[model samples]
Target: MATIFQKCKAKGDPCRRSRCGHSWTVRYREPGGRSGSQREKNFPTKREAQDYGIKAENDKREGKYLDPSAGKILVRDYAREWLSRRSIKETTRKNYKNFFENHLIPRLGSKMLCNVMSSDIEKMCQGMCEAGLSRRTVYQSNMVPLRSLFRSAVAEKRISESPVALASLPRLKTKRVDDKSLPGGEAVGAIASAMRGDLAVSVWLMAGCGLRIGEVLALRDTDIVEGAMRLRRQFVRVKRDGVWKAELSPLKAREEGEWRDVPVPSLVEHALRHHLRNHGVGADGYILHAHHGGHVLDSNYRTEFRSAVIKAGFAGESWTAHTLRHFFASSAIAGGLSLLEVSRWLGHATIQITADIYGHLTPDAGARMRSVMDGVLATTNVSRDDS
Candidate 1:
């Protein structure tokens, strides 16, 4: 039984109990809140009791301390919360969710949010690379999400610092070069030859006017007036419950940037009139559908374009649906249109994208410029000779 005592001395102090065998004494309060008696303990030596008392006091302090529960939170729980707080479009959110579900959670869900160290994350990334995932994918899987999680943890006071601060990962490289443009004349011919339904007319607009796939699909019959096609909305496919389907959403262009009017070529206008006359518009009055009814999903056009490419023998090399847009831009540059004009036609937010993709055409433009300069020089020399 433990005793509560006060004014006691440990053994080996000069004060000794001559008659009793007890070697040491202690001064302590009783365990209860009441007044207590002083007590002394027998010790083989003074050092023993002194050491025991010091250890007991240390243990008491430790027992009274409370550690935080922040380290106990799991990585998976915080990840879900983080995703919910992000302000991204529905399609973008779906993509992030897929990456988290398929790649992130399965690997690191069991980790404690606060206790996840940099070494653990680095090992996970190395493992992913060894497993044949690309460097870009590994960064997406481990680096991006871990950084976001640790940042949140710091904000919530769950972690003191992000462990991945010094980590390095590979940068994403562009998958392929951007030179797959076809000639505009060939594009028009392909559209004319491929006419079987209203789809053929939409193909003509896309190839001739350089419209995006989404923009082309979202057109309404009423959008065309006086031989001009109006661009307003863009259709995008989003994943819902693991299935991807088209949704006719508003244009993703910036504010006050929804619509553009493109003049239709004579042949394209004839085709459009033919499609509208024979098929008639749908209840929604979209122009580029079977019998001019129902909205055409972008996927439908991609499939038809690929089929057309194969039929026209353009499939052997690098022609794709997007080749038509590139073809339009390249042709415009080749036809003496300024980069600024081409940029506006393509609805680019900036002219740099237009110049980067089509800047190679400047060489052709420069050749013609040099010819005109030489001709002017020759005329000046001939006038001087006549004088």
Candidate 2:
């Protein structure tokens, strides 16, 4: 049986020549006729000494217990290790790293992983909000990394529980803007009028076929066959350490039910043919290329496209590259295509997204309930004349 004083001695050595001089001691007896005795130098309070001793004894009994030798590990250290194992795209990883380095680390880096409580996380979020970050951006740029860090700690048994659950942060409020769709007929004509060279073909593909910017840049001459384009690859620019690098990768879910061939409109096909004939395809067979004969980067088109938008007086108005995709989906739906078909064309994961984003565009959507009610009344024949 261990006494409180004996437990204190088991903790470790205490400073010698102290005022109270309450030195707790421990003795270890070996089976092989060997005995060892150790004494803590001195403690001011017997209670402090006893508490330390009890913890040490408990740790000794439980092999799983480990005393924090260098204090608790900081949140920042765990975050780095967590990110190292994440299987995300290069761009996503870079963004996560940036969020940690720029926002999370500077504020909570020194906080002990085990000691961080829900209050600390809530305060951090409030600070970010006060700093003028939008609620959505704050969640993504700060809370995301913190949540991941706490989750990792829980999984590694570094801490028994995650504080993220206690934080109970609310989702950011978002207004679904009616911003999806191509520019109006006048704006489209203006863009077409202003665009020359390779830019013209790219814009045409986006507006006419609903191709994403990445898909447009990834298009190759060989991809166009028999008035159809095979969708396979997408060109994306990922920021690595503050510099953007262009990469050509296969489209996500290109196999196992996500891939499809899209029919090219006659005008788009003609424009593609003209661009290929005049500029000639790259050695890599890409239809779009930089002036120096490499893949056309998003930045390159961004500058040119923004300039064209402004010159056409659509700048600071209802026009963006993605709007062209919206335009394609809207046009397809209005032209008597099913929602599922439109979703497939846009490479969306589900038709629900297609319906949600563009459901308001249906001319009869608002009157659907009224139409149903009218049909019910007509079938019952309880009209005013009958009454």
For every model shown, what is its TM-score relative to the native structure? 0.59, 0.67
Q: lDDT tens string, model 1, 205-245?
A: 76778888888777777887887777877778976688777
Report how far residue 325 has shifted in candidate 1, in Å.
2.1
| Model 1 misplaced stretches (Cα beyond 4 Å) | 1-74, 110-126, 134-166, 175-184, 225-230, 238-244, 252-271, 333-387
Residue 24, candidate 1: alpha-carbon lDDT: 52
Model 2 residue 115 CA deviation (Å) reads 3.5
Q: Which candidate number would show the highest TM-score if scored against the true structure?
A: 2
Local lDDT at 204 for model 1:
74
lDDT of 1 at 82: 85
lDDT of 2 by residue, 1-387 (tens): 234443433446744444445555433221222342332323456676566666655655654333342228887887897899987666667778988887778888899888888887788787888888888788655666667777767666577567877886887543333644357757876876676566778888888888988888888888888988888888778766777888876565453223567888999998888888899887688888877778888887877777788888877765777777887778777776777777787877666667777765655555878898888887675548655
